[model samples]
Target chain A: MSAAAVLAVVVGAAAAKGELTGDPKAGEAIYARCFACHALAYNRTGPKHCGLLGRRAGSVAGFEYSAAMKRANWVWNRQTLDRFLADPLKAVPGTTMGYAGVKDRQERADLIAYIEQAGRSEVCRAR
Target chain B: MSSRIQSPDASLSLASDAPNLETRRSFLGKSGLVLSGAAVALLAGRDVLAKGNRPAGSDVNVLNSALGAELEAIAAYQVGAESGLLQKPVLNLAVTFQGHHKEHADVLTKTIIKLGGQPVSAKEKYTFPVETLKTQSDVLRFAAMLEKGAVSAYLGAVPVFENRDLAKAAASILGDEAMHWAILRNALGDAPVPAAFMS
Candidate 1:
C-alpha cells in the first residue's frame, strides 16, 4: 500500500536470504553415536572404520561379530550408511546391529561427513 | 483491471442481490496484514543472527565424561553378548546397545573435534561386569542399571553442553536410553517403568 512498506519488505527478504545455513560444527557433535560402534582405526570398538567410505561390512579386524553382519557383503559408503542408519533392521534383516538408525537425512549425511573427515585425521592414520 | 472489477461487481449483484466491496476489501486487508506479519518475523530472525549473539559451546569435559561412560557401557554389553549368558532376544538387545553407544561416541568425538581437541580412544580389553551379573535376571538388572545411569548422566550433562543442538541431541539419546531400559525391564518380567530407582 505504501512505498515505505514495500521498501521494508524488499530489504527484509534480502536479509532473510543471507542467513547462515546448517552448521557442520553441530553436525560433528551429532556424529558421536556412530563413533561407539564404528571407529576410524584398524580396531577400536566394533570395527575399524578407517577409509570406510567404500569399504564392505564385516571386514573389520579382531571383532567377533554376529553372523548376520558378516553375511552382508555391502560396501560402507554415504548412501549405504544412510540407509542402514535410518533403519538397521530394515536395511539388513539379520544384522546384529540392534540400534535404530538415525532418522534424519541431513544428520545422517553430517555424521558420514564427520566420519570421512575423522578417517583422514593423523590419529586415525596412526592407528 | 477496471473491467475485471466491474465484472466481479455485476456478478456479485446478480448472484447475491448486493455488492460486497467492503467485505472483499476487508478480506484483502486481512491477507495483507498476515503477509506483513510474516515479513516482520523474517526480518526479526535475520536481526537476531546479525547481532552475533549465537549460542556458545558447552563444557567439553562433561561431554568427554559422557563419551567415557558410553565406552564403558559398550564394553559391558559386548562382554555380555560374548559370555553365552544372553538369550537370542537379549543378545540382539546387546548388539543394539552397542550401536547406540557407537552413535554416542561418534557425536562426542565430533564435539571434541569442533572444540579443537582429539577424542580419547577407548582402551582395549575393558573389564566386564561379569562379576556383578551371575544370572539371567541379574544380566537384565545390570542392563537396566546401566541404561538408567546413561539417562542420568545425559541429564546431568545437558546443562554443560553449550550448543543447543548438542543438548537436544543428548536429550534425544537419553530418552531412547530410557526406552531401552524400559524394554529390558519388561523382558525381565519387571514393570517397564521401575517403581523405584535401580541404585
Candidate 2:
C-alpha cells in the first residue's frame, strides 16, 4: 500500500475509536504536535489555551496577536473549533497555525477534549 | 535519487508487521525521512521505560512533547543513514546530527522523570511522504525541513518550561537544531540563514 494509504488507515482507525466526545488522553498525545506553538496556561508563539473554551479567538493577553487572529470574529467552541482545526489555513487565511491541521476528526476530537481539560486544570486556574 | 536505499531499523522492530515495515520504511527511505530504530521501538507500541518521578506543573507535558519531536528527529536521521542515499561525508554529518537528537531525547526523558511526569512511550506512526525523493537533494531537502521544524518547535519549548533550567536546555538544543538546519540548507546550495527572525 501507499504511505498516504497507511496514514489514512492508521489515522482513521484512531479517529473511529474516539466515537463522539473523543479521548482526552489520546488527544493530549496529539496535542504534542501543537507544543511547538501553544502551551496550556501561557502563550507561546500562539495564544495560551487556559481559558480557551469560551475565549474569543486570538484574544489572549500579552501574546502578540497575529493580525488574522486578532481580526477573527469567531469564538472557540466545539463546532467552530472543529471547522478551524479541520483546516486552519482555509478556516482563517493568514493564520500562522502552520502545520496542516489534524486531518483526522477523531484526533481533533481527542485533542479538543484534552485542551478543554487542561484549560480547566489547576495550572490554568493558577495562571 | 537512491530509491534503492534500505531502512536501518527493520531489525530493531518488536512488532510483527514485516510487510508494513517494508512499505513504510520504503516510503520514508525514498522520501528522505529515512527513519528507523527508535521509531520502531515506540511506534510499535512497546514500552521504553520512562520511570516515575514527582511530577511538577505543565512542564512535564511540554517536555514529553518536546521529547516526542526529538524521537522523530532521531528516526529521520537514522532513516537517512540506512538509506544509503547519503555519501560518506554527508552520512557522517547526518550521524553527528542524529547523535545530537539522541542527546536531546536523553535529557528530555530524564528531565520528564525528574518533573514527576511520565515520558511519552508509544507513538503512532508518522505520515512520511512517498516516492517524492528521486535524488540525494530530495533527501537533503526533506531532512532540512525536519531540522527546521525542530528549530521552531524548540523555540516554543524553551519558554513553556516552568523550571528555568529546562528552558535553558531547550534553548541550547534549539541552537543546535538551527545549526543543523543551516548546514543542510548550505548543502542544498541555499542560504544557510534564510531569515532575519525565525518567527
Candidate 3:
C-alpha cells in the first residue's frame, strides 16, 4: 500500500475510536432534561444532585430518601450511572426514580459527561 | 398573433339532460378556474403569503407555551424571594427554582427560534396565586402547584413533539420538573412520590 493510503487508514481508525467526543455544549442542552428533577445545588428538592459523579446514591444531605435507595449501595460513577440510566428499575429495583431510562447511548454518555463536569464545580460541591 | 379560439359552451346543452348536473359541472369548472387564479395570485405574492402563514406546528406551539409557563414561574419565584415570608432556606430554594426557570425559559426560547417561531419575551408583571399566600407554608403550597403543573405540561407535551431531539429535550425538562415536584412535596411534608403522581 502507498504511504498516504496507510496514513489515511490509521487516521480513520482513530476517528472511529474518538466518535464519542461528548460536546459539553450539546451535553448542557441535554442536561436541561435532567434539571426537572435534580438540582445542581443542595437544598429542598429531592436530593441535591451536586457532586453526584463519585458520590454514592442517596447520600446527599438534608434530603429524606426512600429506604430502598439508601440501601442500594451503588456509587454514581460513569459506568454505574450509564447502567442505571439505561434501566433504572433493573439497575436498582424498588428505587423511586420513575424515569424510563434513556435508551440512546449517545444521550446517556452526554448526560453523564455533563453531570461529571457540573459535579466538579465549586457550586456543586458547596452543599 | 394566432386567432383566438372560442371553447365550446358544453354547459348549454348539458343543462337540458339533468338540471343539477349542469349546475354541479359549471360550479366545479368555475371553482377550478378561481382556484387556479388564486394559485397564480399567491405565486405572484409568494413572499407576503409566506410571511403571513407561518407553519403552525404543534411542537413550536408547545415550546412557546412552555416558555410562557417558565416566565410565570420565574416571576413567581422573584416575588417569593422579595416577599420576606420565607426563611433563609426557603428563600434559597426559591432562588434555585428561579434559576431553573430561567434555564427552562432560555431553552424553550431557543427551541421556538429554531423552529422558526418568534419567542415571547418574559414579562416583569405576573399574576400569581400568591395573593392568598400569607405565610411560608402558603408559599410552599403555591410552589408545589407550579412545579406540579410544569411536570404535567412537560410530560404531556413529550409525546406530541415529533422531533426526537425535541422530545428528548422535553423529557429532560420533565425529569427535572418531576424532581422539583418531589422536593416541593417533601417541603410540604407529603410523600416524595405521591400516589396520584405515580399513577
Fraction of native contacts under 8 Å reproduced by each candidate = 0.00, 0.03, 0.00
Worst 10 residues of 2 chain A by lDDT: A36-45
Would you estimate the TM-scores of all the predictions? 0.43, 0.49, 0.44
Q: Scoring model 3 with DockQ, what do you get?
A: 0.02
For residue A42, what is the lDDT in candidate 1? 41
Q: Residue by residue across B140-165, what tens digits does model 2's lDDT show?
A: 88788777767766675555454555
| Residue range B1-199, candidate 1, lDDT tens digits | 0000110110111112123434654686787743322233233334434666442322344455566667667666665665578876667666666656766666666655555445556664453335656677787777776677576556544544545445666666777788888998898888898545421
| DockQ versus reference, model 1 | 0.02
Query: How far in Å is the alpha carbon of B5 misplaced in model 2?
Result: 13
User: Which 10-residue window of candidate 1 chain A scores lowest in summed lDDT?
Assistant: A18-27
The window of 10 residues in a row where model 2 chain B has the poorest summed lDDT is B40-49
DockQ comparison, 2 vs 3, better candidate = 2
Best by lDDT: 2
Error of 1 at B119 (Å): 1.3
List candidate 1 stretches off by more than 4 Å. Answer: A1-127, B1-58, B195-199
RMSD of each predicted structure: 28.4, 18.7, 25.5
